[model samples]
Target: TQGDSGIQRKGIILGKELARSLGAYTGDLLAMMSPSVRMTPLGIIPKIKMVEVVGIFESKMYEYDSNLAFISLSSAQSLFGMKNRVSGIEIKVDDIDAAGHIAVVIQKKLGAPYFARGWMQMNKNLFSALKLEKITMFIILILIILVAAFNIISTLFMVVMDKAKDIAILKSMGATRASIMKIFSMQGLIIGVCGTALGCLAGFTIVPNLNKIVGFIEQLFDIEAFPSDVYYLDELPSQIQYFDSFLIIVFSILICFLASLYPAWRASRLDPVEGLRYE
Candidate 1:
């Protein structure tokens, strides 16, 4: 089980940019020195080690990109002056979905003095907060979509009014109430699909690059970049999953259908004689 993956220094990985910033590269000599905290007659001491940078990787994440610095496992052991001992082992499972099951299995197998951790366990709080925020934002923005769907309802209602005579004649000719309802419902659905498609396109395509877009806007408007300090990240980060888009479309369709239902029912139930008499 001790393959290339098990090799690490100070129980961490080194990212490429960080390694470069530290004036180190792969297979090069680098030193990690930890300062001693003590008030003694002899004064403070330092723990240092000459280590080799085995690999340099680049993770897109800002934290990892800026913070990761590497040293070999053997160097870490020698630096800490701990022989035949390791802080912990990091494992990547084949299936992330089965992380809990695999962790339990590994725990049972390894028993005491060993443990397994999954990505969720490491950043559970962060991921949970992200999910909650995404849900909240989605719900909030969906009001805009709902407002757009209402336009469909308004359009279909006006269409019903304009074609009242046609509706009455159709009713007299035995056109079922359900059929009349279907016509209006279909009109609402078409509008809903169009609006939702436009919204999703704008959200997914443009929102991800919100920072660049905002930069362009700032240039146009002659303003600063919207006070970047407010955001935890320098730029907006949006990951529009297909699943989210699919749900957006489904919800839009449902809203449109619901919006059309009441008006459609009213139009269908109108008395043909009375409706014709009005005209």
Candidate 2:
């Protein structure tokens, strides 16, 4: 309706981007060639038909917008000289997440001659690549946490050395080696807990406002950090999953606990006499 007044018997609809690129408008006639051949005086030639443009649609996705075209099923069949036959059927499901399951059921019902495929099956390679990329990024980020854990280990070891004299006095006052170990381990655990909480807080606060932050930085520097034309999006997109955040916090704390092991063991094994030799 937006293009031509109504869908004519041989009407075709063009994607918005395709229409723009071809400088075509509603009520304009476009010629399309079919793969089937027609015999003519000169020789065999491809079948051709001139169809009126009835509508233009926008899908937002660049690939689909620039490439897809549509026409009535009957018109399509007639153009290809396959009257009364359809190449495929499109089905809409209420639950998109169960599309694969539904596709399986459809295939089972259709049996031998027909097959059904879900969108996920149709784009398997793209999803697999995305999954691999996610795994690689996760491993890389985990390395950063490991590096921080090492820093924590060094800091705790320094603290243990500085408090050696106090530890010796505590031991002389009847503090057990187990109690000394517990003290150092608890101190390390407290540090890990605090660091994890702060990191989570900062992540939650920053991720949602990342686009705004980038915009501010761009304004300050007078440069575009992410150009809309190149990226095909007006702003950067980010999502914070609670489950992922929980896993990160757990992993960081686990690493910190492991890092504290050597330092805590060394502090607990310190002999009172050796620790207080110069005191």
Candidate 3:
């Protein structure tokens, strides 16, 4: 385990991306300089010291991976001439989900002159952007469901046109108008249910293997489809949330049900006398 300053007497830990960029490895010496100047006999000069690289940390985020470096608290304090003070405190909580609440508590306890901030509050903008992107994608993906609903609507209309005589016969034989409506509605519901099931099946089957699928495509095309340098990620990321999936399925079914309403109503309103006359 390493401390806040990240400096050790033996060496220092550098961010993985920074180390890679510098072509440095363990045991390699890295010179660090402070902007603060020290007085010398000749003139003022920036303070500089060389330290060995002991380890590298991978944070996965490009911003942190490329920029952050760690040194020990004693080394940092000595180098910066800060005797017994720290800029901030880092706290780890048992439940990450309660970080916001905990931060508030800490802030209250610390009171004026000091404030506690959670990672969520610190990175609120980035998370907000991600949330917005997710919502936009959700809206765009919903078009596919709307298209499927349209298909259901057209199919139900065609079925009702074809079965007009049968519907009229059923109505004359004691089936109520509401029952006729339900029959077509159920037909549409069955189509929607089957479609939703197949979609969920395909999603579950493919999402887990999406990385492999991308790799195959890249190999087939002899191209780097997602370059790590450009994307800042070695591989694609995929997450499956059951609640999100359930919401999508429910929304799709609701759209399908709404689409079926007009067609089913039309089917129920067909005059039995006219339908029988044509037959």
Clash numbers, per candidate: 0, 0, 5
TM-score of 1: 0.68
Q: List the residue pairs that clash in candidate 2.
A: none
**lDDT per residue (tens digit) for residues 1-279 in model 3:** 222234567478887788889998887898888777899999999988788888888877667777888888877877787878887879899999899999999889989999888889998997898899999999887988889888998999899888989988998998988999998898888888888899999999999999999999999999988776677676889989999999999998888888899999999899999778867
Candidates 2 and 3 compared: the better one by TM-score is 3
What TM-score goes with each of the models? 0.68, 0.80, 0.86
Q: List lDDT for all candidates, in order.
A: 0.74, 0.87, 0.85
Best by TM-score: 3
Better by lDDT, candidate 3 or 1: 3
Which pairs of residues clash in candidate 1, taking residues 3 or more apart in a chain or in different chains?
none
Q: For model 1, where is the 10-residue window of minimal lDDT? A: 1-10
Candidate 3 local accuracy as lDDT?
Answer: 0.85
**Model 1: runs farther than 4 Å from truth?**
1-31, 35-41, 50-56, 165-179, 196-244, 272-279
Better of 1 and 2 by TM-score: 2
Residue 277 in candidate 3, Cα distance off native in Å: 4.9
RMSD to the true structure for each prediction, in A, is 5.8, 3.6, 3.2
- lDDT per residue for candidate 2 within 15-94, as digits (tens), equals 77789899999889999999999999999999898988899877655566678888877878888999999889889999
